[model samples]
Target: MHAAVGLALISLLILLLLPFAHHAVLFGAEGLGIGTLRDTYLIAVDAPFGNLAISGHMLAGAVVTLLAPLQLIPWLRMRHPGWHRWSGRVITLLGLVTGAAGLVHILSRGTIGGWVMDLGFGLYGLLLMLACVQTLRTARAGRMRDHRAWALRTFWLAIGSWLYRVHYGLWYLATDGLASNPDFSGTFDLMQNFAFYLPYLLIVELWLRLQRRGV
Candidate 1:
């Protein structure tokens, strides 16, 4: 019970913190503007299209934030009949819209953040699209369990947005002084996406294996 409660509190904290993290541009390249939200990130009405795109991303982030966590809900637990099927349907549809928008927007990001960012987002987007197809194909054949299983795969990919912030935050906290570690900073920045999700995927695979073993 204590563990569950702790996890729930952490999740709540994450939900509360999510919006600020999503507006990462507000915080600048290194995520600097911590307590400075709306005003600090405010755009003059002069840049309407740029404003629209950023707003779209924040909206997309909101959708992803709300939907990604649903996979962990108790009702959609492995044993909950029909729950997985229904949730998987919702996830796949949203995943398509969100993932496609993400890919297109990356081209506009052409920053010093480099190809790794593009690569990471692109790979994640493709994996999600493929995972959705995998789930849909299975669902069409009435293989409901297969649909649930693969939907979890796609769901993890969708959560990469949050996962990126998780990694970026930890990196900043660890490095402390970016100037002293130029080579290290660049290297870490390039590898951030890979580091963020590699272990996550490994753990997910382990969990799925345990689930298969009926634990």
Candidate 2:
């Protein structure tokens, strides 16, 4: 059942990532699909560094998203230890770059929900960097178990944007599209910024504790 749930979650994430990857990464680069992207890369025309930062964020995010699920698979890890190590190194690098680029974008452009959202994402980016560094540190120290725990933490935070969309989509549907309602949008935006990554970190910590106990 646990394996089934994990596979299901991964499948859903892949589904969610596909269109964005296609439109934003592939088509948007060629100046083809800006209309489909909500934020639109054309806005990047005015801020060159901001454009570079977001492009790096999206590119690194794609790499991290693709590699993270593979890292979580026990069979792959056991069967190909070398692949795990090398891929993990790449994932760590990409995750750090992704987080840093995101921070750059937020600092340069400022996020919605004012300073509250900025604070939330700022902490999220900081934690992502710390978790990724700890992942590398633990692995280098020959602490495989601790490394895995930190890697899982890093992966969870790396995909926080996807989780935010998932949560927001469900909530929007449940509230009968309250995201479209001007008055309620601010509350939802704030919730997505803070509740998304922070609660996920707590859940990942709880899972790590349970795993350590062989639960």
Which candidate leads in lDDT? 2
Indicate the residue-level lDDT of 149 in model 2: 88
Off by over 4 Å in 1: 1-17, 20-55, 76-87, 108-112, 177-185, 213-215
What clash pairs does model 2 have?
Answer: none
| Per-model TM-score on C-alpha atoms | 0.66, 0.82
Off by over 4 Å in 2: 1-16, 27-42, 179-185, 211-215
Model 1 reaches what TM-score against the true structure?
0.66
Give a tens-digit lDDT track for model 2, residues 49-68: 66677777777777776777
Q: Residue 187 lDDT in model 1?
A: 66
Lowest-sum lDDT 10-residue window in model 1: 25-34
Q: lDDT of each structure?
A: 0.61, 0.74
Candidate 1 C-alpha lDDT tens digits along 158-208 = 666677777767768898634324333366676774656666767878888
